[model samples]
Target: MATVKFNPKDILYHYCSTEAFHSIVTTHSIRLSSMSLSNDSMEGKMVEEALARLAECDKCDQGTISLLQAQFEVYLKDVDGFGFCLSKKRELLSQWRAYASDATGVAIGFSRDYLELLREEYLRQRDPFLGFTIAEVMYDPEDHEKQVRPLYQQIKHAIDEGDLLEAKKHSPLRSWSNDTETQRKKSCLASLGFSTLMATLAFAFVLKSEAFKEEDELRLLALINRGEIKKLGFDVKSNSLRPYREYELKKFDQCTPVIKEVILGPKHRSPISVVEDFLRCNGFGYVHVSRSAVPYQ
Candidate 1:
């Protein structure tokens, strides 16, 4: 095999949040623990076979692994923040468990049909907020606008009717919230306020149909094709991007175009410069980029 060289600075990293970084790390830690435990349970060939099977099951496609390694290299360049929200951690843990279960099932010679079933279950249980975030960054703004229009209308109608339950049902925090009626009402109102503000901003900046020139669209498509921009859990079909899998985005389904956050990475520019460039070039002011806190190993 030929030796390959890697230069960290040439990679672009993308992450949903600090919580997501922690989750990925935590899952790897647990897998390491399992490998160690297997050593004590079996000897020699048995242990080697077990380890090989585990490694095989844990393997991601080369393209994905390369992408992840590049992201981690960028992350290691700067590290900050130790704490993660409890809810986010739990949500990540659930996803980790599902992934582990599916991999293990396949390694143990489970039926291919069973593996497919597990895959479907895993998709159903993933974090919708993260999914939306990925979709927003990876997809064309026009494609995102189509996905969120119906959900936006629903949220507006629910708020206008003063139906807290209905409004909460359309919130991104729907699964995360377990508040009393008063608290739920307060949460609904807060979300409404934020949405209204975002709507105004979107109209002024993002929703102007003419804001994106033909050349700008071509530029974005080129970036995506060159892998400078990565879109997770979505695919381009018929010259438009759409979610490639099912996820929980019902609450923010309509507002995703207006509210989803975009991430800019140092691979494309120095940290200080990327933000300014993204805002100016993308024509949307809601882009987010990490400056100091890197939470991944």
Candidate 2:
């Protein structure tokens, strides 16, 4: 049986199209070429000949090839115009340091845009039962708080219209006036109280309101951010939520004593900081952290 070998040019050509690759490398029994692979081997000579062809290709760039070899890693497969594949490729592309000013900016902006889309998709699919669904906390400050005001106004409008769900949708964006770490978290916890309470009292409440307690839920979220629990734990790969919840709750409990002594007292701790300090003191170690808290209004 004859074994076909890969052409380096083929690899380069497929890569340049800015698309997923369709070619597959078959792993069959290795057949030695009529040429031996040794330096003196015909197999080696033939492979070298193929590589020379690729090096001399007029369309190829040594600079681009070197950049790819040094920095880029690809996961190519046969999928065309597929959103998931495109997104995955874009994520891989984001790690590269783009040097051209226009290209660099576009690359950075696209990475952020794709990341937000993924986050929104996850949140939509998870249908989280706890935490702030408010608008202020979610708005990006890179846009200079312009996004938050409109979102907060929408929440206000929703409140006036008696649209609780609509209000929940805008609640996470409420961190605009929150200028300190403590304030932002306290505000988030305070807001969650209404979100949880309304859900419990008005709706059927199949999900336990107790599990949605401000402290507990915040701890779980903190653990997730810290990578103590799988970040995707909320996505529920397992049928039972109890195990993941219990695991996070246990970690949270371990931090409680430190939280009470080291964080809950003076120095005006932010809610997020309190959680972080508590976690850090309880074996996670020191983490440099900062967050915006709302000044006293």
Candidate 3:
């Protein structure tokens, strides 16, 4: 892997001097590569996976960003004393400035210039309030905007287009390799998230069905009343039982029973348990003994 000359602190400062920046960076931290990427082969897959996660994160962070922005606006109003408030604000500003510097340094792995460019572009679009210190605003979510998604999509597109080597030209994280256990896990998780999202979307479209006849509608109504359709929503109580008819037509009805058996069965063969067992058996670490067993397997 290529050596990173930049510092994490500097990268942090360049991108995360504000609350919005901090939130965005931390979120990416959790959803993206938790460890540095190291393997060339896994880089493309990891990048694509990271992009999908970022999209989901963007959707979830919108509400948080708005709330943070509102707090920044109302902060002064809530302060009891001017001197105390100013002191607190100053302290926060200093902390954020330092934090931003540190994070920027860390992000130097992504290519210092690229990180800076992205940061500048994001800030240019956001134009956050300049009065408060960077530290004070690092957690506020309201300042986030559309740039996050577009940037993420750009990366994703690059990966899908078979530009793996070129895409990492600016990426800070190393690609995953078998030698680096951390990178492998991070890459695997990203792949899983990408696959899951794709499955959900495809399921929504491919499995779409409609209820056209009266008999079908009555059958749906009966299923809904019987609690076969868990939630009492539009899908269940539609006039023509369109939702029910559609759902039954989909593979979910056939697959759901099996899925539930795997998920809710006493054998404990659910995805979570499977993952836990795999990790434990593979020597990642041992988990506490549980009564759970996978009888199906």
Candidate 4:
């Protein structure tokens, strides 16, 4: 459903600043930011909100509610999820305004097929611990509502007609209070419930605010263990350290380069040859470059 929805033949544009463009062309990689640390303060809240709506359970004791909320936050911070966002609209003004920084940047175009291959490669290796998915962002309410319904049903089944709030197996937030046989059963069921809820995260990552429907975003997201992240790199912006990992784009095995085209932003006053020369110098001679048709200054 991913490549089908986004169209593998379509070129996904990554709008970035001129400096970022230089870094990309030189390194042949893309940067992904942790979802929890994205510019949107509501980045990781959608799943929680959707679960509340679908469960329709009345509020429980303040202590119980706090525990589940804490668990959810722990899960997000436990396996840091990161996303590399791209737009199907090659020259969308909003993207140029948002990601193209200072109204003077470029949109680097990459092949959808190549990106898909990279995702498949990640899965193909069967690392078992690594998780990844590429998909078109869902902005429609009714459409995504249908997507989350099945998970809600599973949760309902797990609790057996008792609402999620009533299924309060809150023995302890982190571990069992005692090793009694009955307590062990409760702990097992609680683990099952949380793990089921975890399945909703992939959907959560690809769903975005409708106010941004114009961007028609597609995301290549990676969710990995916190232990592995400690050894990787991060980027600092706005005085905060964000976990990030770069995916290589340049192909060295005598295949077409993943980068296919580039569009100079409307206010990108650099000559067309600047991008062209860089591509050629970096062994990407087949890439096509053009100026943006938008009239924005």
Model 3 Cα lDDT, one tens digit per residue, 1-297: 233243322312121222322232333321111011111232112222333345566563543333322322232122211000001121122322332333221110122233333333334434321011111111112212221244345334434443433323323365444456445434533443454333222111111112211111100011111223332222222243322111111111111110001012222223557544643453324332222232222
Worst-scoring 10-residue span by lDDT in model 3? 214-223
Local distance difference test, candidate 3: 0.26
Q: State in Å the error of residue 230, model 1.
A: 20
Model 1 deviation from the true structure expressed as Cα RMSD, one decimal place: 26.1
Candidate maximizing lDDT: 4
Computed on alpha carbons, the lDDT of every model, listed in order, comes to 0.27, 0.23, 0.26, 0.70
- Off-target runs (Cα >4 Å) in candidate 3 are 1-53, 57-138, 141-145, 165-297
Local error of candidate 3 at residue 295 (angstroms):
61
lDDT of 2 by residue, 130-228 (tens): 221211111122222232223223333333443433323344446334347445444543453444323221111111123222211100111111123
TM-score for predicted model 2 compared with the true structure = 0.15
TM-score of each: 0.18, 0.15, 0.16, 0.81
Reference-based lDDT, residue 213, model 4: 91
Ranking by TM-score: 4, 1, 3, 2
Candidate 1: regions farther than 4 A off: 1-145, 163-181, 187-208, 218-297
lDDT of 1 by residue, 1-297 (tens): 222233222222222233332233233210011111121222111212222233234563453333333322222223211111111121122222232232111000111222223234334654322221100121244443443343334343443455544433444445544558656665655554455433322221111133222212100000011121222243343565433222221212122221122232212123545544544453433434333222211
